[model samples]
Target chain A: MSKAIITRNLTKRFGDFIATNAITFDVEQGEIFGFLGANGAGKTTAMRMLCGLLKPSSGEATVAGFNIFTQTEQVKRRIGYMSQKFSLYEDLTVKENIRFYGGIYGLSHQQIKSKTEELLGKLQLQQEAGQLVSSLPLGWKQKLSFSIAVLHNPSIVFLDEPTGGVDPITRRQFWDLIYEAADRGVTIFVTTHYMDEAEYCNRISIMVDGKIKALDTPAKLKEQYQAASMNDVFLQLARAKPGENNSSS
Target chain B: MQPIVIENVHKRFGDVKALHDISFSVEQGELFGLIGPDGAGKSTLFRILATLLLADQGSAFVNGLHVVKDYKAIRRQVGYMPGRFSLYQDLTIEENLNFFATIFKTSVEENYDLIKDIYEQIAPFKGRPAGKLSGGMKQKLALCCALVHKPAVLFLDEPTTGVDPVSRKEFWEMLQRLRQKGIPILVSTPYMDEAMLCDRVALIQKGEIMQINTPGNIVKSYGKKIWAMRADNMFRLIRDLRAFEGTDSCFAFGEYLHVTLHVPVEKVQAYLTPLQHGNLVIKPAQPGIEDAFMQLMQEQNETV
Candidate 1:
């Protein structure tokens, strides 16, 4: 499979502190790649660099065949980004938010109309199209935000803690949408605190203190760490003291 | 009287009924969990019990003090950590803890033993402002402030909602330790897995209690055979399984889909074999709190 994302020795530094240090990995097209880390573990910094939002202090990387340093705008156009905190405009109606995001992605008037119709139909939001985005349930809003993110058919979609506080049923429904996107060959680069979600990824990388401590499929990681679940694997990796090389590469 | 008793509590905001006939009680030194999703009336019930908000009907008591009649007394005897971190952001960690201690007519030194373990973790950053702390650190500081007065009961609202797994585990350990100190804790969370850590959990939804029992008992009462099904193409497998006639309910759980069936497992295997699902695996799976919660919610929806 062709590569959707690649990073070699990706590093970011602020003054004397190194936020992301010498991380290397590759995400295959259509792969569900999970980025796991604690709050201060530099996952955000590394993701920002890959998304072309922040310039790397050093190293090489490419997202959707576009170089991070030179083709930043091209990189942005080929990717979709969403986070739990910010996604849709609360003041706008559901259809209006879709149109606004469609316009932002440079979709034509005809394309925007068709996309809006398709989204409303797929999400079963036909009745809610006129409702204010803020008026919808949290689960509905999350699903709508995800649909809007992928409206432009970007090759890769980046989700930052997208399923943070929703109910169990809604959380599974959100993953169903994710599975649909991945089936369509959209590389999913996502981050989550929930370990169960970790098991859903095709492969995952756990970062510790600004380094890639472990990277593998969920099954292999469990076997390698002698753990029953991904939660145990995460705890064992994250709890290792800094500068300790407990992971067997 | 129980340390915390909520009897037929109801709250409404205009047209929306925020909580409906919510009733439960926490025994002394027990760690009782109110397990549900956001907007499930967990926070609303917490506010009512903590005397922060009045219920439209029914009653609540904290340490035998009526929530409405003895609001002031309840406030003095219960520690409430709201869903959002409600602390003096401009104040340093030490200042916030000290301020809360002073308000409760106690000193940090007086209750140092109560919050010692939690405080020492954030003490190194005592000089830093509360707003400057990380999510985990901020949570620890807030917990420390809550226990500084050493109230008779503790109320924590979604303390580990957005926290990572590692920090969430550590936070639960702290709660377990606090329970040993004989303070009844009434906590709320959106995570189903965390429900198992509590002594007992009330599976709540849409401002109503679905069931309340020990976590083990709740799982035991699922009363249905669940099977774990997986294949090379998970998306296709789920779609096919959901479309199958014998499938009752299918939801993804980690690597496999936890499916409840109306027919035998052999029938499911025979049906999927022809659909070209490679490496197909189907085995009997144990039901968890989440599975039981989903079943209860589905039943409630059908009845409504």
Candidate 2:
């Protein structure tokens, strides 16, 4: 019931360039939160800060009940992250990748073996566990990545465009796994350019020009903008005239 | 002759069967859509129709020419824009368009009108590297290069996926204008709302077509008792109403939680008391393409 992630004026800057301006938001426990924006809209920056990979410039954020500035290690320990291209080692078998990820998370040998079985069973990848990851289809690779991310049983998992180029059916099946994770009380924080995938999140926060433009349930944001769909919600807030270049704020 | 037609199509990549006995025909001058999420065989089907890939077992024709037998002819009559920015990112916009035009044995001046409307927007920046352009600009450039050849059938794979909403709207408008020229356009999208923009769409999932219907007909076929409810605390309202006896399905749609009734609407009082007391406004609602697709998905799952 407590806030899994809370931010106050969280900002991230690379040199003088502000990737994320002074922004504030909170992600609740067990909520599937969608962090959305165009390619360079600071969603990734904010998420990196939460994941403890990036520190804020002049703000504070608490992720997984740990102060990001002082307790980054604890924050990292309690959360999982899957990047946009989080494919497992292609040459390794499916079970091997799970074991590797499980090992990195500090699970015991027996524990890793059991969890590997568990993940394969959940993903229906048990029969293909011995096959090389490269041989598996992209859809299966996505499921495997998520399985490894959550195999450690982290309270919060961050997924960045986990289904970027996969087919729609695979994307749908991948989302079903995400929903299952949330149902099991794993708070999901995900970023995606796919508007339809954004709709799958319980609530979405849209970023434009390094600022949070709209933050609410996909439905609420759609109505507030009077747009027909999330794509419209994004359009209304992100409509910059031609020649108006974003100053990389 | 149909601009595109597929009969008993089957495709596989290695051991993975990507498309199953898929069959469909797209008429000339129609804005047909292939709607699905990832891994729905939309791309596979597009590749087969484009004649860029061969179907393990099937036959297809584009503009009355066989895909396998007359691939060279089909290539000349099709404009294919892949989902990704598959153009030469290092080249200038003008260069990319010119390159595609030249490949078709044509010149920029030859088919300038085909791309003029889209090109005008980027004319000043024509010398800019394609990669330097914004998502919207890149999208317009991709369209220009694809159309510079002035093909009869245009295939766009999720053309508006990553671009902003305004550009998506603009891109669809451009397609409509091209349709006026009687170019049979085929586009794919993961977003359900875009389905409404097409004349007819095939709702596909898992290498199969769920429904092939006009978006209007798809929404109309969802003959369910639907209502929209909203309040200051809409999230809580959704949670609370889901437990209401008459509530069958409650999905967040637009300003309200679209609630489908398990019972008749006249017996609404049994449910509205708690909702009204919670300061929520409830009204009857119409289903959209998404709702239709979702219902169809559930029905398909139940049957399968």
Candidate 3:
């Protein structure tokens, strides 16, 4: 499989502080990669750099085979990004939000109209298409936001804590949607605080302080760490003292 | 009287019913958790108990003081930490704690013993502005400020919502210490796993309390045989299990799909074996707090 993301010594520095310290990894095409880390562990900094929202201070990286430095726009175009804080407009109707994102992605009017209809049908939101996004339940709103994120069919999608504060069943339903997208060959690079969700990833990278401390399939990481669950594995890796096992692959 | 008593309290915002006849009580020195997802009225109930908002109907008591009639007395006796970080952004950590202490007609020195353990963790950053601290540090400072006055009871709303697992564990440990210190704590969280750490948890959803019991009792009383099933294609497995006639409910839980059956496990295995699922594994699984919560929510949804 072709590589969806590649980085060699990716580093981002904020003045004297090194927020992301020369991290290196690759995500394969259609792979569901979980980026795990504690708060202020440079997960966001690394994600921002890969998403082309922030410039790296040093090293090399490419997303969707495009250089993050010189081909930033190309990288951004080939990736769909959704964050819990900001995704859809509450005031806009479901269909309107779809049109807005579709237009922003430079889709033609004909394409946007067809995609909106198709999305509404698949999500069974044909009835809700005319209603304001705010009127829908939290689960429906999140699913709608995700559908709109991928309406333009980008090769890769980045989800930042997409299931935060959602109910259990709905959280699983959201994962089902993610699985469907991944089945269609859309690479998923996601970050989450929920460890159970981390288990759904094909592979995971746990960041501590500014480096990738552990990166592997969750089963292998569990075996290596002698953990029964992903939560235990996360606590062990995140609580490890700095300079303890600097690298694990 | 219980340290905290909520009797059929009801709260609504315009057309939306935020809390519907919510009633629960916390014994002295108990660490009680209100477990639910966002928009489940946990914060509304907390605000009513904190005397920050009035209930539309029914009543609540904190330390035997009426929430509505004795709002002033309740305010002085209860330490409330709202879900959002509400400390003075421009003030240093020490300043915030001192400010809270002063408002309660007490000084940090007067109740220093009450907050010593938690405060020491953040004391090194006492000079830092409240807004400058990291998420975990801010949480610690907030706990210290909440404890500085040494109120009769404590109300923490979603104290560990967005915090990482390590920090969340530490925060819960702090709560456990506080419980041992003989203060009743009414904390709320969206995470179901945290419910097990509490003395008892009230499973809430959509403006109503579904059940209130010890987390262990809640799981034991799930009243269904749950099975853990997994295959090479988990997504398809969930769909197939949900489509099965004998399946009552199926949900993705970590590495396996936790399923409740109407028939037998042998039947489920027999049904799925023909589907060409690679490396399928099926075994009886214990129901957890989340599983119980989901079951209750489903039953509630069906009834409504």
Candidate 4:
């Protein structure tokens, strides 16, 4: 029930283009939180800040109890991130890639071995462990990327549109892993353009034109806004654009 | 022979094997959907069938023409809309449509009836550059160009990704209308809900076919009671319910968490007491296509 993420009036500005307007929200420990938005909606910007990759133009935030601005290194050590692209060296075998990433994260050789085996086994990747990362199929790569992201047993993980262009069946598999991790008390923060995926989150926040206009469980937000689905909620806020009312009760 | 037949096909790019032993056929006039994510090999399969790329090992046919041997003939009968908006950015919408039609040895006037419905939606912006139109408008134009020749088979890769909801719905509606013409359409999408709209779907993962069935049969195969529930402390509710011994699998579904209870619903009491006096709600429900996919994945992992 503890807050794993907290942001207070977070803001990001790039040459007067308010990439992320003043926003406030919190994510509880072990919760699967979906960050929903249209393209260019600043979902990426906000996630970058939380991942310790970018600094907020203003405001304050904490991830895993580490100050986002000053203790980013500490925060980085406690979290894992998977980008939209299942980024792994295409030439490296799955096992090598895991070792390299785990090594960079300072995992001990023995620790990396045990974790790799466990992950590979759980993901049904034992048969493909020796295959080059690029040789593996897209669905395999996606699952591998997620496993690598959380390989070090980070307290929280961030996924940036991890299911952007994969099949529904693969996305479903990805979510099952996410759920499995969440069941083990790992907090998950992900951004996705897929409204259906948003429904899988314990709570969701919709960003439009650099501002968060809706935040709640998908149902409450839908009911509160008199919308039917996440898609409707998105359009209702997105079409309102920059000058319209942007907050919900 | 089917309109489109892919037999034990495989494709690779450098070290990346995009498709592996994928085999399926599209019946003439059927709406076939390839449902998968960005890298599920949807594009690779589409390109192979469109004769833009060749499979490494297997054979495929469009209108019973070999994709490799009859590439030229296949090209004339298939229209492909890539995932990205790839029309000439500088060409006006109307110009782009005309150009595409000309490439197929046809004219806008010749196929006006075929594309008239979609074309009308963006007609106002026809004189504007293809890049200048909104995402939805651009999508409509792409469809028009693809249909200008009225090919017997059409290929659309991730056609609705990043587009607005209304436009997504409208685009699908247009596809439905096109189905009336008896053209076998092959569309790819990462979204599960859209799978229901297709007459049949091929669910792929890691470049392999997972299942191929009509949407209705797929739903019928999922025999689980899903319940959606929520309360004031939604986060707390999600955790407590997930932890309860009898709970099978719980996921956030819209406003409530879709949960599977091993115990009877009337038995909501034994666990309801601990959750009582707390701000939460509980109820039983049904599974959507997405839910069924999750269960299948879960089952696959347990056995694998």
Candidate 5:
């Protein structure tokens, strides 16, 4: 399989402190990679660098077959990003929000029109296409944001805690959409607080204090760590006092 | 005597029925959980029970005193932690804790034993601004502040929603310890897995109680024999399983699809025989609290 993303010694430093300390990993195309870590564990720093939003202090990487350093704009065009906090524009109608995102992704008007129809049908929001985003339920808005992110058919999509505070049924539906996107050959990079969500990924990487402490399939990680679940595995790696287990990488 | 009792509680905010005919009782020394997703009325109900809001049509009691009638007494007897961090972010950790202690007319030293384990963890950063602390540390400080007054009962609303997994685990452990001390804790969370940690949980939706029982009993009551099914194309498998006549219900669980079959395993396999090109794998699966909750929610939706 082709690699969608690759990084070698990815390091992001702030003054004397390193936020992301020489982490290295590769993500294969069409893979759903779960990035797990406690808060302040450098996952955000690493993700920003990967997305070409933040310049790496020291690293070598490629995203969507483009060098992150030399071709940062190319890398940006090939990926979609959705954060948990940014619900679609509350004042805009569903269709209007879709149109805005499509325009930002540089899709043609003709392409955007067809994509808007397809998205409404796919999300079962035909009746809501003209409704203000705030009028829809939390679940609908969340699903819409995800669809809008992948509207331009980007090579990869980054979801930062997409299912936070959502109901179980909506969460289940969200995972189905994730599977659908992955089936369409789009790589998914997601960070979540829910351990169960971690188990859904093809492979997961657990970061602890600026380092990847464990990276493997959930099953293998559980077996290797002799833990019952990802929560236990996470606790085993991160339960230590802050900065106690920082090894010089 | 019951520590908390909510009887026929009905609350509405303008055009929205925030809570509907909600009623439940929490025993003294019991760790009770109000489990539900967002917009489930957990916060409204919590506010009423915490004496912060009054139910429109029903009565709520804290330590056997009326919420509206004895609001002052209830406020004194309960420690309330709102969903968001309610601490003074601009103040130092020590200052914030001391402020809350002052509100209850008690010093931190008076209740040091109650919040000592939690406060001591953040004590090293006592002089640091509350906003400067990390998420986990902020949560710990918030818990410390809540417990500083050492009330008879505690109300924590979605305390672990945005917290990290490791910190969430530690926070639950702290709740367990607090339970052992017989404080009669009332907590709410959106996480289904955390429902299992409570002694008894009330599953709420649309401001109504769906089910109230022990997590173990809830799973045991799931009458269907679940199967963990997976294939090469999970996206297609979910649609196909849902369309099958013999399928009772199917939902994605992790990498596999959890299907409750109306027929025998062999017949279900036979039905999937046509989709063998996808290399479908099927096996018996254990039903978790989440499964039970989903089943109940589906039933509720269908009835509506």
Candidate 6:
């Protein structure tokens, strides 16, 4: 299988601080890859670089078979992105939001019209097509945002903490959509704070202070760390940081 | 003695009922958790118990003081950390703590023992503005300010939400220490996994109590045959499982689809024998808090 993402000594620096230091990893095509890290562990910086939103200070990387630095526009066009903060027009209706996004991706007028209808049908939101996006429930909005992200049929999709405050049932359904997309050969790269969600990925990379501390499948990581769960494995790695305070836990 | 007691609390805003006839109690020194997702009325209930809002009906008492009648006294005895960060962003870390301490007619030195462990972590950056701190540091500071007064009961509303996994783990450890000091803690979280850390948890939804018990007991009461299942095409697998006659409910859990069935495991195997899928695996699985919560939610929906 071809690699969906590749990074060789990918590094990003801000002033004197090295936010992402010499990180290297590859995500297989159609695989769900979990990127785990603490708040300041440079997960976002690395993701920004991969998404072509931020330039890497050094090192080499490719996303969706395109070099992030040299072919930034090509990389952007080939990937879908979603974030914890919902980025839809609250004032717009559900159908209007879908059309707006579809247009942004440069779909033809005919293509946008059909895609909008298809999305509404898939999410079972045909009844609410004329309703404001803000009036919908949180779960519905989340599902809609995800569907919109992949509306252009990108090869890879990047989700950053996509299920932050959703209910258990909604989260369960959202994962189903993710599984559906992955089955259709869409590679998934996601960052999340929930340890349980981390187990859903085919492989996980745990980053600490701009470095990839542990990268492996959940089962293998558990065995290597002698941990009962992903949560324990994370705690073990986080505690190993040099001169780290707040170690009582 | 009970540090907190809430009886038949009800609240509504316009046509929407924020909370409904909620009642529970917290023992002295016990770390009690209110577990639910957003829009579950967890915050509404927290505000009422913290003496920040009044309920339409029912009564709440902290240290035997009524929430409405003795609101002033209760305020002095309960330390409330709202769901959102409410600390003075313009002030330095030390200044923020001192300001809170002064408001409670106390000094940082008076409660130094209570907050020393948490405060010291961010003490190095004590001179920095609160708004400039990292997410984890801001959380520690917020927790420190909450404890600066050394109140008898601590009310932390979703203290770990949006916090990194590492810091969340550490925050729970700090809560354990606070409980050891005989300070009762009333914490709330949307994360179901954190419920297991509490001595007792009240699984709440839309202002009503779904179940109140130890996390272990809740899981024990699930009493269903669940299988952790996966196949080459998970999407098709879920559809097929739902169509199977024996399936009671099917929901995705991480990489596996958790299916609770009415029939035996052997029957499920027989059903999958001729399925047009590859790499199918099914095994008997233990139910967790999330599964139990989902089951309860499903039952609640069916009844409604």
Angstrom error of the Cα, residue B93, model 5: value is: 1.5
- Report the C-alpha lDDT of model 3 over B182-296, residue by residue, as the tens digit: 9999999989899999999999999999999999999999999889989988888988998999999888889888998899789988999899999999988988999999999
TM-scores across all candidates?
0.97, 0.80, 0.97, 0.73, 0.95, 0.94
Instruction: In angstroms, give how far residue B185 of model 4 lies from its true place.
Output: 1.9
Classified by CAPRI criteria, candidate 4 counts as: incorrect
After superposition, candidate 3 runs with Cα above 4 Å error: A240-249
lDDT of 5 by residue, A148-180 (tens): 999999999999989988889999899989988
> Model 4, B132-222: lDDT tens per residue?
6666677888989989998888899988987645557778999999999888899998788899999999877657777799989888888
Residue A100 lDDT (model 6): 91
Best by DockQ: 5
Per-model CA lDDT versus the true structure: 0.91, 0.82, 0.89, 0.82, 0.88, 0.89
User: Which DockQ-derived CAPRI band holds candidate 5?
Assistant: medium
Q: Residue by residue across A1-249, what tens digits does model 4's lDDT show? A: 788999999998887678889989999999999988765667878999998999999999999999999999999999999986667999999999999999989999899999899988998889988989977767788899999999989999999878766655566568878878888899999887677778778899988778888899887888998987888887777652322221110
DockQ comparison, 1 vs 2, better candidate: 1
**Looking at candidate 2, what is the lDDT of residue A114?**
84
Chain B TM (all candidates)? 0.98, 0.94, 0.97, 0.93, 0.96, 0.96
Look at candidate 5 and give me any clashing residue pairs: none
lDDT-wise, the better of 1 and 6 is 1
CAPRI category for model 6: acceptable
**Candidate 3 residue A15 C-alpha distance from true site, Å:** 1.0
- Using alpha carbons, what is the TM-score of model 5? 0.95
Candidate 1: residue pairs that collide:
none
